[model samples]
Target chain A: MERLLFDLSIAIERGKENETSPYPPDLKGKPGAYEFTSRLLEMNCPPDTILKQGMMPGMDRIGKKFADGIVFIPEILIAAKAMKAAMTLLKPYFDNGAVLRKGKVIIGTVAGDLHDIGKNIVCMVLEGAGWEVFDLGVDVTKEKFLASLNEHPESIICMSALLTTTMREMEKSVTTIKQAFPQTKIYLGGAPLTSDFADKIGADGYFPDPHSLSKHLTGNL
Target chain B: MINKTFRFSTESLLPDISLILIEMGYSIPLADHYLSDLINDTLQQVRKHTRVQAGFIMLPKDSIKTQSNILFENRLLFEPGSIIMSQLQNVTSLAVFLATLGSDFDLWIKFVQQIDMLQAFVIDTIGSLMVEKAVDLLEEQISMQAMIRAEKCTNRFSPGYCQWLVDEQHQLFHLLPADFDWVKLQPSCLMTPLKSISGIIGLGKNVIKIPYHCAFCDNKSCYRRLKNRKGQ
Candidate 1:
């Protein structure tokens, strides 16, 4: 079981979505995360175990590589796409509560920023890490975040911005949410934001990559 | 509220070299026309003998003061406000030398036209790859350095954020080395390199540095904060 899980993780990391998908060119014509994950389910391997051990670890590697600059956006995006493809098979388990989530995270690109690449990457990594992510998408408003929080009181909030102009939206949202719910932890990121900026805005934390964020959340939980 | 810093160094000269290549009519793939204009401006003013070196440092919020100055001499984008201020420091002695190189209006015009042509060709092929590579190199270097220093650095932050006021450009400029004569920050706080970067990094021991969510922050009216908290 462990060996199969490791194989699936390697597939996801290499961006092998399925046997027919041709990516990472070197792995062409080989079974990918999709086939492996489906096979694991057919074999009655628990979905929770598969997600926790297989998909999460693969995402963790991709996130660390991204943070270390060992990989760029294109590579990370491919890995994320592969992970998402595998995730579709497990969605039913999640809905049925057979695969319990670590927690909920509300994520989005703050307002005035149309950029979604970074936000999408984080969302995928967090999902792979076993968190239920409520993606608010680009140009998210504070009201939407608050409403989401109201609906999912246990959810953690994350904000992203690629433009300097939109970074202010991240700060505004953090400040508003913290005031309303002081206990809620907020995570902020993007090309233009720093931990200093996050601190200045009184956010709970700031991380450069999703792997570090996932690890931090996992340890805390 | 964890403060951290990470730094690393690599022997990549691609960014600086690419700048020179663009000046010599070597087309940069995927670059927008405006980027070429920005690069041409730097090429014209840079000294011939000077070389460019760049570094980034992210400080704690309390370490830096935020302030704003009027841009365009009088045109206000909104009420004059302070956004997060980040500094991009470049040492360009050659740039200064090039600036002193006697100006030839005709040559300059022709150079501009060449850059326009290159931009048209490269935008589709490599809009920001060259510049992105440069930033990536610097980021990797700084991150490794920070890690060696035992400080976990978060991602780079630039000016125009919530707490760090864009108006604090002068303060960041103060931290820059005095030797780089070619590059200058205008009243609007724009860097001459056009390819140069300015941002902040948090230095500390913690692994995860949480950012304050703008939606929950009390500074609701911060001009730099994004207006849409929820999706439109």
Candidate 2:
């Protein structure tokens, strides 16, 4: 069982989806995360164990590689693809309360900013790292964020803005959300964002990439 | 001279898969079959689905004024900075331009995101490259038009780049014709289609186009920084 779990982790880290998935040439035609996850479930393995051992390790490895710059966006994306394949099989378990996620994350692009690729990437990484994420989509107002937080209290708030012009909107939204929920932790990311900018906006954290945010959320930073 | 507009089909842009791959951080030789297929498929989708639109208006030689940090035209000013100002110093004229892949391209990306995240990313990257290619064509056209008058083109600079405050986009939009609706700038000054590029290019005998030096900028999350680092 341990060996199978380890193999599942490798499959995910290498971005092997299944026997037919041709990515990562060396892993082509090998049993992938999909198959490994199915087999683990058939063996009556606990859903939490499969997720914590088999999946989280893979996400952690890829996230570290991303932070270290050993890997790029495509690699992280493919790893995310594999992780999604596994997650699809584990959804029922998650829905039935057989597994517990680390925490909830509410992510969105601030108002006047239509960009979502960076935000989506963070959503995938956070979900892969065992967080339940509520994506509020593009051009989200502070009111929308507050409403979402009202639905999922104690959730970490993450905002993305790709344009410097829209950074003002982000600052406004952050201020409003913080005022409404003083205990909420707000994180910011995007091409034009920096830790200094986050600090100036009273955000709890800023990550240049999704992996750093994941690391921080997991308390590994 | 009247302001001009040009619309291009994807065929004219000649999207370069290899160049896009390089920008996506993949070496040509290392772009394996999967990546190659992925890029090719996305390119096809982009060609079939994207609406590549670009337009530019020329400001004649004497109508423009410049200070150390301000580009003054039509009694409006944009503070791009010392670096951009220095680059624009020798221009006899300026071309204010806008380019976009239109909203359909964005719709396709949003649709793909619901199904495949990696493919959606590829589509998004390709969409960006396509808009840039469209802008490149517009710049070349402006340069060609300038060449007829014995003028050369300087490297293009956008409001959100090279120390230019993004808020200046509002000022840049004001320079366009009132009827110009190819791209709409939001109240925040970001374009509506979201995958749009707007900027100015200088044309003159002494305005030489040089490689963009990312080292002088401090936008650490700038993808150009990664591309530059990769080149090193």
Candidate 3:
């Protein structure tokens, strides 16, 4: 079971969606994450086991690879897509509370920024890491962020931006939330944002890559 | 002796330029360094590929300008506007390499070889061309709409340029796509392509028109210009 789980994780990391998927030429014709995930379900493996042992580990490897620069964006996108495919099969279990999420996170690209690539990656990694993410999408306003916060009060907030101008909106949103809820921890991230910039903006934390952010969040929680 | 020749057109790749750069091993932060080398290599390749009196134009600061013209297409939240400026004198250098389309045989062979170098050479060359073309298109578009030469771009200013600070990257984010392929800028205004650029242009008059040689300039804080001078 452990070996099967490990193999599934590798398949997902390599973007092996199924036997028919042609990407990662080396893995052609092999059963992908989709097949193995369904097989696990059919074999009566627990949903939590599949998630903890299969999906999570897969995303973790992909995230680590991204951080180390072994894989580039196209590869990461494929992995994220494969992980998403597997996650769909497990959604029912999560909804039924058989697999409880460790926590919830409110994520979005701040207003004036139409960028979603980084935000989507983080959302995928965070979801694979076992968080129930409330994606606010691109160009989210402060009101939307605050509304989401009100709805999911226990959730942490993550702000994403891809432009120098939109980063200002991130600062504004964080400031607005902190002023209203002093205990609310805000995480800031994006290509242009550094640890120093995060501190300057008064955010709770900053991460260079999605995997690091996932580890940081789960480690503390 | 690097004798390899490569080339690609920028006609269909205005927006996705950064994505191509990432695939070429040029990260956004390291883009400038690779760009300098790419430019040099491209010039050499052009020389070998065709016989044309190819040269580049290094605009002075005084010739560039920044003009802003707002346009409302729909009721979208963003009030779109173009920032036009004269970037003439401020241009550290604008070197262009042109090679006539060579004999069909050499052109075809070189083109195929260029495809193989896409991850290394073609991307940067295309990126440089796109940026230059973008500026030119922007200039022409702004001029046509404004009914005048709006402003001159003093120089191409990117993140971490001189003492301008990298934090300013946030300002440029509002102008670009959030997730441009693998090249996304985070909330902090950092670009993912790792080979992208951001810079400033002083519009209007009173702009300084300095020569290409950095040895004659008094601004000691100019990083790239100073580096070039030292190499000489």
Candidate 4:
């Protein structure tokens, strides 16, 4: 096990952003993911190794914890924040193809739903797992989803709705997009949604949490 | 034609704001202190443009004649049901109100969305608590005014709850004074500032049970249920 990579993972897992960051207070004076990642890049460490070993494992652990109900939204949120700090350092490598992304994802909260917390968390974890995410934000419509998919032809769609009323829009978009692009997959999630509801609405998959979504993408894509 | 606006100070909300930190997994004393520091920093940044507004329109008892899908108010008629029938049976008039956490919160949400999602989530959680608390404070005033008249009323019932179709939000928005322009209702019936809330409270003869506030409700997202469960 690489010590530098291991340190980076610990920083992200415990949500240590930088040396000055007061969170995970036990680690107050220690270098955080930002410094560790930056230092690793300078040390000629492979960007892919840092992402695969340092970032992904930490995020995967937390995502699993999140799925198991051991860690709640706030904890997952803070961890995602830590992963993002390191991810910023790695983005240049992703662009230059030094470290390849797993694939592209289009995710959003559907139209008529203003809630973005669930959708945003999912996006962060997916991106941390090395996917290029196109976040469509809240109140996104089927046309926008479809258009985004066309732009990133390799992208899979993930729609989130936090309200029962807005969840119907998921079914509507699922029905419409499935008809037009029969092979394309659309995933559904949010508080009021269920796997049963997703199947009823013709969605290809259902994610109860972001880690599950990330796992599905890793295994499937 | 009674219209009023309110601004709730965040300082006055100190005690109640603990739940926001608690939900952020900061319940223990030391963690609570650390998270409180983080929250205050974010609150200061967010407060620069924080604009929370709550508006109310008090109507006379004779103003509303509700019929399942349609409500006849004065000379105007609007459709779809958000009006709780049981609550209306004993009231002299109803108070229709709207509360918004403002576009600045939305802007802050967007700002933090990219930079600091944890703070963004906390901000999101706090905005909700703030708007709901503001709404409750306003409702307390209405409840007291009704008490003075010796008239009891039901708990608020908003559109999109119970059998009330969300489409009726159009009708509810119609009842509010247009001069209360802090919040806007979209064609989709969703309000802007996203954290905004609107509902009707009937001045009647019975104490109505508020949904989500009930301990018996199985909803994990209900703040009251969470509060009661942990005694927060």
RMSD of each: 16.9, 2.3, 13.2, 3.5
What would the per-residue lDDT of candidate 2 be over residues A1-221, giving only the tens digit for each residue?
99999999998888998878887888778899999999999999999999999998998898888778677788888888899999999999999999998989999999988888778878988998899999999999999999999999979999999888889999999899888899899999998888999999899989988888898888942
Ranking by DockQ: 2, 4, 3, 1
- Name the runs in model 3 displaced over 4 angstroms: B1-133, B136-155, B158-232
Residues B168-226, candidate 2: write the lDDT tens digits: 88878877754457578888888868778999887777767776787557767666776
lDDT (10s digit) by residue, model 4, range A5-26: 9988888888888888878878
lDDT at A52 for candidate 1?
82
lDDT measured at residue A154 in model 3 versus the true structure, 0 to 100: 90
Report DockQ per prediction, comma-separated.
0.02, 0.68, 0.05, 0.46
Candidate with the greatest TM-score versus the true structure: 2
Q: Per-residue alpha-carbon lDDT of model 3 for B167-194, expressed as tens digits?
A: 6455444443222223345554545333
Q: Lowest-lDDT window of 10 residues in candidate 3 chain A?
A: A69-78
Task: List ranges where model 2 is wrong by over 4 Å.
Answer: B27-33, B69-74, B177-180, B205-211, B215-218
Which of candidates 2 and 3 is the stronger one according to DockQ?
Answer: 2
Per-model TM-score of chain B: 0.44, 0.89, 0.36, 0.77
- Candidate topping lDDT: 2
lDDT of 4 by residue, B106-163 (tens): 8888887777777788788777777778788888877876676566666776776544
Give the Å shift of residue A209 in candidate 4.
1.6
Model 1 residue B195 lDDT score: 36
TM-scores across all candidates?
0.54, 0.93, 0.60, 0.86
Candidate 1 — which residues are off by over 4 angstroms? B1-232
Q: Report lDDT (Cα) of residue B101, candidate 3.
A: 27
Off by over 4 Å in 4: A38-45, B7-10, B13-17, B25-33, B45-47, B62-92, B206-212, B215-232
